[model samples]
Target chain A: MLAELMLSALLLLVTYWFIVTRRLSSAVSAYSVQSWLLGLVALALYVDTRLIGLLLFGLLIVSVKGILIPRLLRNRVAFALVAGRETSYYVRFPTALLIGAGLSLVGLLAATRLAFQPQLLPQSVLGISLAVFLLGLFTTIARRDAILQVTGLLAAENGLLLLSLVVAPGLSLLIEVAIVLDVLIAVLVMGFLVARMRDAVAGTDTSELTRLRG
Target chain B: MIDPALLLVMLATPLLGGISSALVRSDRVRYALVVPTCLVTLALALTLIARILATGPVSAFANWLYLDDLDAVVLLVVVVVSTLAGAYSIAYFRSDAQGHVLRPGELRKYFGLFHLFTFTMVLATVSGNLILLWTGVTATTFAAAPLVDFYGSHEPLEAAWKFLVLAVAGELIALLGFLLLYEAGIASLGSAYNFSIPVMEQAGPHLTASLGAIAFLMVLVGFGAKAGLAPMHTWLPDAHSQAPAPVCAMLSGAELNCAMLAIVRVLSLVTPANKARAGGLHEALLAFGLLSMAVGVVFLISQRNFKRLLAYSSVEQMGLIAAGFGIGAPVAAVGALLQMITHSLAKSLMFFNSGNLLLRFRTTTISEVRGAIRVAPASAILVIAGALAIAGAPPFGLFISEFTIIRGALLNHAWAVGAGIAALLMVAFLALMEPFNRMVFGQGRGEPLPARAELGLGVLAPGYILLAAVLVLGVWIPGPLHSMLVGASQVVDR
Candidate 1:
């Protein structure tokens, strides 16, 4: 339980790093490390439960979320690396971090309040998972860079993955695999759209994507 | 007894069509491949519906894929709209290619993606497993994203990006909801329980109330976003307006229904647990429904773009359907199901008309285009008719369905809800007709009319067919369709 709590704290730290980091590359790397930790948590659960499904799911997470998606995202935004951290945020860093912390607290409180079966997993894991989920959503809204928003979504997705691992690892293997595949496809599609945005709008900032509003 | 093999055939037709269309370089061959594929899929879907109606629900592949009365209703809407959109795309894209708005290569991609989009909707409809259903719904976004950005222009790319981001975020929430639901089921049914719809339904009584409530709300907000219910409906207008006309027709007419179907399926499981829980779910649906109606109406009154006008109208109509189901009376549920069909017909017809307008006037702004009748007489008349029909005027299908829904609300003794529906309908009717009346009839603002552009049979046929269906359904629903609607409603009423 202590080990799981530590991992959860580390995961939360990585997500915070992702939010504060201005460089797109660093944000992506933080996401990668966060995904790896998620995979590690899954593996630890597998060790305790001896569920082969969890074992495969852990590997799948590490390989897909940790490795493949970040690489793809990096390639898509490689040009933005040299462009020197575009300076436009709907919310500034400090306020965003404070909001993130508040969201984490809410997640923690909600997890405790809910009548989650205690024997399924550590309560802290569930709380941290929800926190990461909300932070990811916050990251998407607060950042203007399209790539940052995508990472935010991925972060949220990782949070979901963690929650599912703890709450319903008994979910069918086919479904777990299919969900991963769906996320991969969504990332691929988002990456493609970001590329198109670059070519059409001449940059990847979502602020310029204001043409379609009411 | 329906043959399970038939289901496989129905699904495979589109999968094969999508692959072959992508592989075939020739435009003629691709059109031939896609159009027939849609027709074949539609025929098979109808056959399956008939069989299900006759013999009850059918499950295959160990209940991983199944169709009941509920699935049939959604499947019917999906197949009809997608088939029409498929046929209409030929004319739509041919014009685009000729106008040099799209190159030949892009046309191939459109057909490929179009069929793939259809496949995903079908998959979602027929998925017996909850997880597979979620996967299929999420896949629809990925499939349609490229098509939404087919123009490769600034506005479309923007719309596609927003569509992707918002939809993914919403579906992620829904994913969490499904996880919670699964956990709820495990709490009751043990870890060995299946995630199939029937299993979930059976386990509903055993579900923990708090967990079930949270799960239902998550699914509601998540799928509600996809279904174009406000305030999550921000993506609907942008994506629908920016997409090509046929794609708009499909998005408004079909894809939204598939999303709604997911919500309904989850509601079926969650609400069966107990009365208080059911009532709470109903209240949530009613609130979202009414809010969406108001949002759609307000936006409709101030809209500059005709396509956006139609998109907002969709938001209104979806709201009506949601509210109808929320009424939780048998009559209202039936009305809601009927509204789904009628709305699809009317909305697709209006979009087709908008496509015609876009083709001729080369703009979707309501203020810019005048003297539409002189520009293209057939399309102009159809546009007015479509506007009237969608606005719930008498002698149109929507009016009947909307009336039935109000009657259902009154039967439930929900007078305020009934009055709200009535008032919104009245304002929406006026809001809808005002711009369309101006655009279709008035003399131009000193701009030369395009000389009587000839709309091909391909484009006009779908609109006429849809308009005819909407009109006929207003007056008389065929016996089989009436029965199908009742069967579908009973699934919810249970």
Candidate 2:
């Protein structure tokens, strides 16, 4: 239980870091690490609970999210204007990171309020999950570039995966497959659009794509 | 046999028709087939509606589809709108430069994509799982993307891309929500969850309450994008106003409802204890719905484009439906379902008639077209009827449904009901009065409404039929439908 709770907090921290930092490659690498930890958590449950379903789900997460998704984005997504210097963030990185920490603490405080049987997993997993969800929302709102926005979108997915891991846990590998398939499709479409954006507007900035503004 | 053939046909006919029309290269044949194929679809929808009503929830391919009372009602509305949209499209395309003059190949692909979109929407309604439902949504976005850019112009293409980005981004958020749901409550097997409503519900108690709440919020925002709920409804007006009229009908009439259904199903699975703690998802929906309705009304009052005004009205209607679900009572739930039915029927009818007026006037700016009564009298009457029904005038089912929602709100809480009623009146007035003043009496700088291709009686019939059904539904509730509504409503709880 302690192990799962720790795992959830660690992943949440990593996601917040990925969203707040300035270096594009480093942020992507942090995200890859986060996905790896999520897969590890999935696998750990597979071994601890002897649940065969988690193995396939874990493997898919590790391979597709950790390896394939990052690789596609990295290779297909050109440097994307070398990051940094976007106008207007809801919160600065350090502040968002601090806010994320505050959310995690609040999450823990709420978990105690739930007063569950105090399994390490159930007690703190709730806090980590909620904080992660908020951080993802924060990232989506803050980011300007399309690829980064999509990455924020992925972080949002991670938040959800963390929440689901704590809630209704025994769905199947099929849901995992579905998630990966959607991610892959999204990556492809965004990749295509990224190139199109570059071609049409001569820059891959998402703000430039705002052609239909009121 | 659950009649897999019928399902396949539903999927096939539109794609085939789209292709042949593109290939034939003659506007005459495009005119010939669009109406006939849609009529066949209407026939199929009617039979499907009757069969579902008679047979009670058709399940097939091992629970992939559980077409029951709710879906049957939706399916009936689809038949009404899509058929008329099709007939209207026939006359509609004659004025479309590309549809009339395009090389066979370009025409085929455009029409093919349109049918594919219809098939995807139908599949979304019939689907029983969350993932497939999401897939259907993504499919619609992709299919509509090219159609929006069909004019091959820079601005439309840009609009299409923007539409894709926001909608896909929103949908991905929804996908994440569903995934979290998949992760909820570890059974002994200790894995992520399936997309089944039942599986999630069965695991409800075992799951962490906060996780469920978080999942609900994410899915709400996600589906809200498609449903045209505000703060996330940015893509809707731009897309609807720019897309072809039939496409606009599909976008408003069917796709938004499909996304809303996904949210409704997810909310139903929220554990009772969690719902109590979080105020369920209703409060959240109510807040968003009211914001959307108010925003829609404000925009509707200010709009000058005929099509844009209608699009804003859709946003307002969707908000009302969302708020209905948020009210979270048996009466409110059924009211929400009935609204879904009536909105689809009326919006499609409205869009189809709008298509006719467009053919007559060759422009969509409200300032450019007027005295619809003088030009295309038959279509004008249908469009006006559609507008009246949508505006919550009596005899339309929407009026009954909307009134039921307000009354349900009042019964639940007088203050909330009053607030809701005010919003409805404001929006309803904006949509009906603002547009009619100009459309019925105002004149624009352009060629007046022209008499074009033969306006088929079939084209006129579907909109009126839908309005007629709306009228019948307002004053009456048949016993069987009442039972189904009662049953579905019982599932929603605080």
Candidate 3:
């Protein structure tokens, strides 16, 4: 239980780093750490429950999300990394951090109000997961760079992975595998789009993608 | 008693087509493979529908794949629209190739993605496992995003990017909801809990109320975004308008309905546990429905681009269907089912006409394409008819379905809801017709019609066939179709 809560806190911290970090490379690395923490949480649950599916899912999360996806993103958007540091955001850093804190509080309150079963993990994990999820969503909305947006999405999905581990670790292996595969493809496609955006719009900044608006 | 292997064939035909299309360099060979593949899939879909109506639901692969009346209804729409769109793509792309608007490689990519898109939708519709259904819905984003960016220009890429971000984010939220639902199921079913539809339904009545409510709300918002429900419908118009016309037709006419089917599936599961929860869910559905209708109508009135206007109209039509289901009256539910079919046929026809206009005028701006009747008389008349039909005019299928929905609302003594629907439908009707009337009859912007502007029989046949189907549905709901709608609605109304 102590381990789970600490891991959850570390996960939330990494998500915060992802939101406020200036360097695009730092943000990508923060997301990888966040995903690794999620896999750790899943592994912690497996230790408690002795469920083999949870064990496999934890490894899957660690390898695919932690290792494979981040590497893919770094390679795909190396140009953005070379450009160095996310300079523009729809929401500035201090304000974004404050908002993330507030969202975390809201998640805490929601966790208190809702009746999560919390099968084997600590209950606070639910609130932390929700906070991570919301912050990831905010990151996507707040960031201007296309690669940053993709990182935000990855962070958000990690939040979901954390929640699923706590609430329903018994979910079928087939489904877990399928969900991971879908995210993999989504990343591939988003990477492709980011590459295309760089070519067509001449920058990775999504705000420049303004020609299609009503 | 139909062979379940037929289901496997139905799913594989498109995958095979997609793979072959990608491998073949020649556009003619790709088209030859694609059209027949679509037709065979349609025939298989029809056969399954008949057997389902006759023999009840079909299940295969250890019941991981299943199709009942409700699935059949959605499958029917998907197959019909995709088949038509698939057949029409040859002409649409041929014209684009002639104009040098698309390269040979791009055409091959288009057919490949088009079939893959169809495959994902079919997979979602036939999936009995809730998780598999969710996976299929998410896969569609990946499949269709490239198609949206087929032009690979600024606008198309922007649209595709937005579409991808919004859709992927929404599906993640939905994943949370589905997981919560599974948690709720575990409370009663324990280790027997599977994410299959039947298992979930079995677990429904015993689900924890609070968890179930949260799950349904999340699912509503998440899937609602995909279905073009308002507040989350920001991506719909941009993506739909920017995609190729045939792709737009499938996206609007078929894909949105499939997402709605996912919502209905969850609703069916969530509503059975408690009355208060069911009522709250219905109210929520109605609120989103009304808001979408209003948003769709407001945007429809001010729209400059014809394709975006149609896209907003989709938002409105989907809202009406959502509202109909929200009413929870048997008649309303049935009307919503019929509305799904009518809207699919009519909207696809309108898009096909829009494709025609785009081909001739080289612009989707309503102001630029005046005097269309003088250019392509057949397409112009069909456009006017399609506009009227989609706007719920009399003697059109949408009118009957919309009326049935209103009548169902009134029958339930939801007078305010009934009147609200009526007023919105009226405003939408005028908003749709005025622009279409101008486009079809308004003077050409003093420019001579382009030579070879008239459509070939191949391009126009799908439009006429869709028009005929829409008209026939308005006048008469065929016996088998009526039964299918009733059965499908009963699944929702329960």
True contacts kept of each: 0.81, 0.29, 0.72
What tens-digit string does per-residue lDDT give for candidate 1 at B362-456? 88899888888887888888999999999999899999999999999999999999999999999999999999999989776787777887677
What is the per-residue lDDT of model 3 for residues B404-464, given as tens digits with 9 covering 90 to 100?
9999999999999999999999999999999999988887657765663678887789999
* Two-way DockQ contest, 1 vs 3, winner: 1
Candidate 3: RMSD to truth: 1.6
User: What is candidate 2's lDDT per residue for B174-209, written digit by digit as tens?
Assistant: 876665565444432154334554445556666666
After superposition, candidate 3 runs with Cα above 4 Å error: B1-3, B276-278, B444-447, B451-453
Please write out the lDDT profile of model 3 over residues A1-214, one tens digit for every residue: 7888999999998899877787888888998899899898888877977889989999999999999998998888787787577666788788998999999999878887876675776678888888999999889889988888888988988888888777777777888899899999999999889888778877688888888767
Query: What TM-score is obtained for chain B in each of the predicted models?
Result: 0.98, 0.88, 0.97
Superior candidate under TM-score, 2 versus 3:
3
Candidate 3: TM-score?
0.97
Estimate every model's Cα lDDT from 0 to 1.
Answer: 0.88, 0.69, 0.87
DockQ winner between candidates 1 and 2: 1
